[model samples]
Target: MQAFRHFKRVVTDWFLCGMFLATFLAWLFPRFGSSGGSMHAEYVINIGVFLVFFLHGINLSSEQIRHGLKNWRLHLMVQGFTFVVFPLLWLLGKSVLGTQIPALLMLGFLYLCALPSTISSSVALTGSAGGNVPAAILNASLSSVLGIFITPWLVSLVVGSGSDGIDLGATLLDLCALLLMPLVLGQLLRPWLGRFFARHKRYTNVMDKLVILLLVYAAFCNSMVSGMWQQQGSAVLLMALVGSGLLLALILWMTTRTARALKFSPADEIAAVFCASKKSLAAGAPMAALIFGAHPGLGLILLPIMIYHPLQLIVCSIMAEHYANRPAPQAADPALVSAR
Candidate 1:
């Protein structure tokens, strides 16, 4: 049991590496010889995303919601940074990249900006760093819920015309089906299932990993079927990677500075900065399917998130450690001090 716990922790913590390695293997093997099962990848990706959100719902606590409401300023900062500032940056990126970038790729970038702030990772990092875990949980959860509506609208406004055959109404319905419905269902049953989820935390972690792996395989398979890999050159791919890393770094720094400028508490600042800055591939994948439709080549567009997700984790992990080890500030709450 202990060994299994350790293994699960390693996998969850290093999920990006596992996802990249899985995609690499799938690409290397070339399942069914170059025709590419990218559609299959998309199917798996959507299902895995659904399951991920369901589990996310199960873990949410009403108590967290209450606390989050109390910390309205922190919540506002995080959500504002995520939905407002990030999208604006993507608009600037689009202007700069122009025709040098494919519309599909630009749409993918817009989708990245539209994604909700990450929940498990932000809270995990905050907790590990001795920051405000409850606030992190609330801010991240609210961000996901808000993103359901805000993301689609943003995509429609910015990338809709560029996309072929997109039905905004239908896509919104799908979003409701894929995300909002499950979230509401989970919240409704939370009172009954909460204890079970707590007790079977190990199983839940396994499920999380399994779903993500399946999603990656399906996304890659769809890309293969659509010849997404063949469509782009190595130079463009490398440029996309560099561009993605720089974008993430800029947002992280910007949000951190913004939080500090707002006079947020150290814990609130950490939570706001981390929660506001990061994007979730898990959440973004299904929305990509809805927005991009049969263009599995667009799945390749998600490659940046796959790369950025892990980098954020590693970088933030170190930052979390640094914060955790720092001397306690004078204004630190007695309750937080006790919790730490």
Candidate 2:
């Protein structure tokens, strides 16, 4: 039992293991996870998505957002990197190296790029590194909310005729109805429900992971039925993993340099790099379901972010520890100092 517990700890440390297991299960039994599968996975996934966003709204503290609003420069820098610089980098890579990458993977990269920084991971890492935790919380939350509107427009602008002829106007309406409405409703009821969610945050996290896994399983199940894996095979997946790592490294370098060049304080720099460099799989998965729902290549397009998510967590974790060990800055933000 002790050995089993240790093994479970090791496996759970990298959450992507669960996703890979889901993909493997999908491959083995595609019919169970396919859109019209025996399990009726579509209905389950839809409900799961709604609940995930609703929980997000309840957990997000308006007071924290208000407190974090004072650092305009840091916020501007972080948001710019997330929304502007990351997408620009992807576009440039596509222009120069487009032919080298599979078309679907390129699309995946774009979606990954346009996504907002993840909320929990970004703030957690910042706090761990003794960075501006409030700023991280605000910027990450803001990014997720903004991406609800901006990501679709950005993808529609460049995706042009690729996403099963997605009608941007229709897609936007669906997202607002599916994602935004639940979020707003939850936020409105936060006064009553917030404490319950706070106490059971672990359960909400389990729900979030299960939803993402279901999406992955359904996506791969559909792709398997269409024989997408046969066409692309392991080679494409290997490229995606390698490419994700390189892209993450480049972004990390850029964020660090840009933050230093702007002369941001150490804590702010830590927050900027972590918040700007990370992308949200939680946001990306549902948005993809809405935007590219009809596309046959949905699995391939979902590949990069799936690959990028674990890679960023692993890499940023090391970076966070390094930052944590660094000597205190001569002058630190009072908020950050207090956090430590």
Candidate 3:
């Protein structure tokens, strides 16, 4: 039993193991996850996704909201890094490397850059890293909300056929109805329900992981069924793997430097760095399905997101462990220790 516990700790410590397991399961059982298969998995997954955020709302305290909102500077830096800086870096890479990078990969890179920071993973990573949990929650939620308006507009600029390829208006409606509405409803009822969640936060986390797993499996299965890998040749796929890792390292370094440069508290710095550096697969995958559903290279676009998701998880897990084990400071944020 003790040996089993240590093995479990190691697997859970490397959280990316869950992501890889989900992908392998999807590949092994593609028919069940495929959209065209007998099962109508998306409908069930959507409901699960809704409940994930609804519970998120129930747990979000009024104090968290108030405190998070007060840190406008942190919010701006995070949003800017997610939307503006990431995209520009990709653009520079493409321009400098010009035509050497596959056009399909470039499109994928642009789409990945345009996405907001993730909601579930960013906060989870921050919490694990012993960061300011409330600030991470607020920034991530705000980024998702803002992406509803910003992502489509940015995609339109880059892709030139966003309107014909994707119904921007419909995309907005999906985000608001699916992600935002349930969240708002939960927040409204939190006064009565928050205590239940206070004691049951672990369940809330389980729900988050389940939703992510479903989405990742479904997206990869659909892409594989559509013969996504065959179209992109192994060389380009390899480049994407190497490039995604490099990009993440660059951003993680910058986030830390920016946090220090700006004189943020160690806690605030952790929150900002983790939240800013993550791209939202939850938002991006669905948005891609809607935007590029008809496009021939849909699977290619999803490739970077799939690769980056696990890469970020592994990298962040290392960082989270390092932060969690850091020596305690006299004035450290209480929430940081709460993670340990």
Candidate 4:
């Protein structure tokens, strides 16, 4: 047991480090000067996304859905913060950045904002923080479902048909294939497969991370092959990193405050803030390819999500640790305490 626990910790630490290194390398090498490999990477990424969402469905419990509905206010708040507030802020940021950033880059940022909250990380972070893990799972899952339509519509409104080639119809189809279909299928099979999934939770998470990492590599490779890095210099990239990091920080702080003001317990507040503030690179990358087809500009545009992903993980990991270590407050209600 001790050895198993130690190995688990090592793997977790390595996973975190690997994610950071991957982002740095993607930024550093931006292009591999390799041909014939882009198509393979794209194919692998599409398959990986499909598997990731399917696994996401397997882990979701009926209980979580019931709890989510019972706490509809919390669900609404988290979703609103994700789909509504974040995109508005991105638009405001775009105006401020103006032509200093390319139209494609701005659209990329908007697209990232329009994406749903992450599932694995949100639940993992909330669990680590001793927060409402069920709520995190529910909100994140529902956000993805909502994103099927919300994201494309938001992209249409914010991005339109610039030279970057925002193809709304294709992107919608991609979302349905990569995200919605798997989720629906998983739900349909849950009665039969739930037990199997529950028994292999560890392996499912492994599959999830592996799929996401492959997707990341493929996205960066695609950008590289298209000469994405050459077009957008280092200065714009640096600005995007700074802008996205600051934007994430601002939203995290704002949601944390709002959750508290609304009198959500600390656990719910942690889950809300974490879920609301982060974007899913796993979901965003494929959508980017679909929306910005054949536009090498996508490489520059996806920079924000690439930068934001690791930053949010690191920051939220620390916050989660703090919450986990803090002493539990007196229960506001005995029923709630027992339920948790």
Model 2 lDDT tens row, 39-68: 787688889999999999999999988988
Q: Estimate each model's TM-score.
A: 0.85, 0.92, 0.81, 0.83
How much is the lDDT of residue 228 in candidate 1?
A: 74
How do these models rank on TM-score, best leading? Answer: 2, 1, 4, 3
Best by TM-score: 2
Give lDDT tens digits, candidate 4, residues 221-328: 557667666676778877878888888889988998899899998888888888998898767766666665545565566778877876787778777777788887
List residue ranges in candidate 1 displaced over 4 A: 1-14, 28-48, 161-165, 330-340
Clashing pairs in 3: none
Task: Supply the TM-score for candidate 3.
Answer: 0.81
lDDT of 3 by residue, 88-150 (tens): 888898888758878878888888888989877788878988898899988988887788778
TM-score of 4: 0.83
Better model by TM-score: candidate 1 vs candidate 2: 2
Q: Model-by-model lDDT, in order?
A: 0.75, 0.87, 0.78, 0.76
Clashing pairs in 1: 36-225, 37-221, 38-221, 38-222, 39-222, 41-218, 41-219, 42-218
- Model number with the top lDDT: 2
